[model samples]
Target: MKKGTSPALEVIVATHKMYVMPDDSLYQPLLVGSDFFLNQQKGVTLPKNLILDNTGAHISSKNHNYSELTGLYWLWQNTVKKDTNPDSFYGLVHYRRFLSAKNKKTPLTKTELQNLINLKYEIILPKKRNYYIENLYSHYAHTLHIGPLARTREIIKEKYPNFLPEFDRLKTRRSAHMFNIFIFKKPLFEEYCEFLFGILFALESSLTKEELTRYDGFHARFFGRISELLLDVFLYTKFPDLDKRSDVLELQVLELEPVNWIEKISNFLLAKFFGKKYKKSC
Candidate 1:
């Protein structure tokens, strides 16, 4: 609990499929859709190294709609809330994405993370993903439905009106701390989870069953995408001087898989210039 002390930090890597992970105690590989696999795919064996998100308190059944957030919900209820150690730190990262070092290729080591913690940083986040050609709102509108985002603003107005200002500012920004990746000290972690799920649950209730299920498997996971934007809204509202804050650390992110830049750029251009919505993941 004291400053400079090496506190326990656990970063859960939310994964639905098997993939190689970093060789470090700081990272835990969690199978997000464990419940579905167990119930729906009878007699199937799972990896022993991975933790199942379906255990204890969980929303594992909603993995289809919530994506990696199911693993986050599991961590919130079963780990963060239950742990007796108040100084413990927690984080969420995707199986293929990770917080990286200066070289931007190596995964951050525990010693490096501890050094940051010792420096009194309460939060660690991935570097911003910039869409130089378009703002966040326009990018989402071009690629995904704007209805959910519009309704999210309405929900913020009704429930947390003060956040409306920051939420509206997202329209003017081209870069964002995306992928819903972050590491937080216990207090901030709990506060963030409460604020985040509160808005998401309200948004979920606002949509009808048909509206939620109408999208293809890829697009149906709008809940996760929506939360990506909400992260900024929550941080900005809670910490107005976030950019200047010494307590927050933004590290580079490493992508395990090779990206097809040409295809991704083509899809973005097609979505923005043409009327074609993204049909598949790049």
Candidate 2:
């Protein structure tokens, strides 16, 4: 593929509970957000792009905790077999969030996205989310589960010992790739999903029933959170020069509109004070 030449890019927007309309700019709009096993949600309209992710041991009903990862799993189990386009790419974005174009505000429209895909970049990632004041450990400790973080490290050490160094180093850093969203070619996407689910499943099996049940909705999404950090670890391992500006492998970084600071702060506070009451009501 030549620079400035467009390619077929298929991005899967993993929306768990929400059924937002798809943007017209992207090549293929594959929505992976169906509720699995049962119909718990009342009024979600399955758009034409819907990928029913409820089957095959899905965690669709637990979207509050698992986030968009449930949709990713659906793609892994069912969608991969049908892909045949050599120029095709696979990506995951959120219904609420997307990888903005150069404007740093809006999601990439068809033309803008075509120009990007033309470059045939190895990876397309959201801008690195930095925690300038404190490193990754302190930031995660303040907002998310400290136990799962520790357990995840141990799991990496025990199962993927070679990745332990990257895992350890990643946690100490001040910033990392957040949101677990990205665009990768077919090969990289498959490899990533395989590795990611491997670690998550192992951790799940390692937990006792009591220990597992202890994590309410607030913390049950441990795997999803850990996967955010692992994205960096995975890139660093594959492309050692990933952080540096180099021509060998181009990693396109994009920014989106600012996140809802007010809502985030409110949720954090509620998690601290109300405890798992948030889960109870939901």
Candidate 3:
């Protein structure tokens, strides 16, 4: 708990490129596709502060398909679970999206994290993103290929039947804690990884080579996007009273980059009304 010693909360910022990071010990910048980057660009130098996902028991080669999830996998396999401190908290944030404190400009600091812990918060998440016009299923089906998500539901029904109800409930909901972001105390972190990765791995095996390759570049990263929905399934199934739980906290997401709302809305409308799929990131 001492500031000069090990941090109480360690949040890794997943990034594929170099960028300015918060000047706080709590935030660690991670190079998501380090192996691929190094192999493709032999002469380029990487920042020392950015930890490579390729190191020690990692699925670094899958970064292209898994996206930032490779970083999460590396952390799960090689970092947090190995920590000596049982009470330590761990989390993942993107280089551009972070969980903001009350003022909305600052990233959640260790002091604030400690305060949450003191108040009995075992997990912290971003506020749910609402698609007022569409439920989560229709929203995803509108913007992206729904095949993988539908396949995921089948996997849940077969392998985790208890979760099937909540998974189906997603069709009726318009909001979700998305983007695969979260902070959790050690135990919950491990439990989440086990449940999440188990489903993803099964889904991965179920895909045909053709199914995986049929999508264009943006849609190929289905694993990461699909996991975003699974977070809610895991939380809601395990803790049905999640909203009332003193152990869970939801915070605002701070977008470090300016969002192009006009283009984003246009794309959403096109996808929802015109049956067009997204071709690029917004």
How accurate locally, in lDDT, is each candidate? 0.88, 0.65, 0.89
TM-score for predicted model 3 compared with the true structure: 0.95
Residues 63-98, model 2: lDDT tens digits: 544567877776666555356555666678876667
Candidate 1 local lDDT, 53-112, one digit each (tens): 888888888898899999999988987777766688899999888998777578887788
The list of candidate 2 runs beyond 4 A from truth reads 1-8, 25-33, 36-38, 42-45, 55-65, 245-258, 262-282
The lDDT-based order of candidates, best leading, equals: 3, 1, 2
lDDT of 1: 0.88
**How well does candidate 2 match the true structure, expressed as C-alpha RMSD?**
5.1
In candidate 3, which residue ranges exceed 4 Å CA deviation? Answer: 1-8
Residue pairs in candidate 3 whose N, alpha carbon or C atoms collide under 3 angstroms: none
lDDT of 1 at 2: 22
- Candidate 3 lDDT over 1-282, as tens digits, reads 123235457889999887999888888898898888888878887777889999988888888789999999988888776776768888999999999887769888877888888898888999999989999999999999999999999999999999999999989989999998999987888889999989988998999999988987799999999999999999999999998988888999999999999999999999999999998888
Per-model tally of clashing residue pairs: 0, 1, 0
Candidate with the greatest lDDT versus the true structure: 3
TM-score of 1: 0.94
